[model samples]
Target: MTWKKLDQIRRENPVTDEEEYGQAYAEASLAFELARLVYGLRTQAGLTQTELARRMGTTQSSVARWESGGSLPTIDLLDRLGRAVDVRLELVASHHDPTSSKDSPSCAVAFGAR
Candidate 1:
């Protein structure tokens, strides 16, 4: 059956049981994407770990730890990193058409308003 048909059926059958699965998938996906973005931006700026450390006003080892995934950054750090590199991060998102019947629910991701 088509998604539209499935969605119609789902309206009557709300699959509440899958909520935890959907939330975990979303969290994992978002974290992975964010880490990739930070690594990509740092490399594209032609910055060494030391250079990025200087720009971030921290230590090279700290930068290395963050990049190596021993440390994760806060949202505020992400904005600062983008500023230091002079490139804006863009996250494009959209509604999964209501008819899609996907297990994942819609969410708000932090794409810069600019």
Candidate 2:
């Protein structure tokens, strides 16, 4: 493919409406939240992920995965993460009801990944 074609592909696509814009906003917000959590934890410990891993007796790759949410950390790992950041990740229930209940938990209702 030509450089021009590649450049065009790299450019942001236009959003057509409020619905599309809100969807994009939600996805981007989730990504930002994940990144921020990772960064905050590492920085609070006054260490990079590598250094924090060293202190936590784990591999930097492990930390990297958790930070990016590529892999969810275990409860144990989350406790360690909290220690590293001097903050806790608490579990809170949503006020919104699930689309599917135990009797009908088969279908998923989402606008998209967002």
Candidate 3:
């Protein structure tokens, strides 16, 4: 058995069926992005997980889960997190034309210091 790089493996067997994997890929990407955002917010606020959880009225385990991307936070939870971190949270939705070359419709979360 020989070692093969991930890029080499991907090049050998590319994803030919976007329909089968697009949704999963998008969901994973969003989860990763959200995890980074949560971790960033907590760190920037100089708060430990326990402190952040206390401020949000949630458990430290829940904060860990969010930071790990193991769970997706609800809108209400996001609002609480924003308040806990002293940041303004904005959720934006927009439609994208399927016929266009652009990607599908998606939502975004913007954060600003309060």
* Highest-scoring model, lDDT: 3
For model 2, the run of ten residues with the poorest summed lDDT: 105-114
TM-score of each: 0.54, 0.49, 0.73
Choose 1 or 2, whichever is better by lDDT.
1
In the order shown, the candidates' Cα RMSDs to the true structure are 11.0, 10.6, 4.9
Q: Residue by residue across 1-114, what tens digits does model 1's lDDT show?
A: 999999999799876769887997687676666667767878999998788778877778876666665566776677678777886654345576877655554553443223
Clashing residue pairs found in predicted model 3: none
Give the candidate order by descending TM-score. 3, 1, 2
List candidate 2 stretches off by more than 4 Å.
1-32, 97-114
Q: Compared with the true structure, what per-residue lDDT tens digits does model 2 show for residues 14-77?
A: 5568898898778767666766776776877688888878766789998887677566556566
Worst 10 residues of 1 by lDDT: 105-114
Q: RMSD of model 1, in Å? A: 11.0
| lDDT for residue 6 in candidate 1, whole number 0-100 | 95
Candidate 1 runs further than 4 Å off: 1-17, 59-72, 90-114
Q: Supply the TM-score for candidate 2.
A: 0.49
lDDT of 3 by residue, 1-114 (tens): 335687788889999899878988888888898899899999999999999999999999999998999988888888888999889988867675667544333777675446
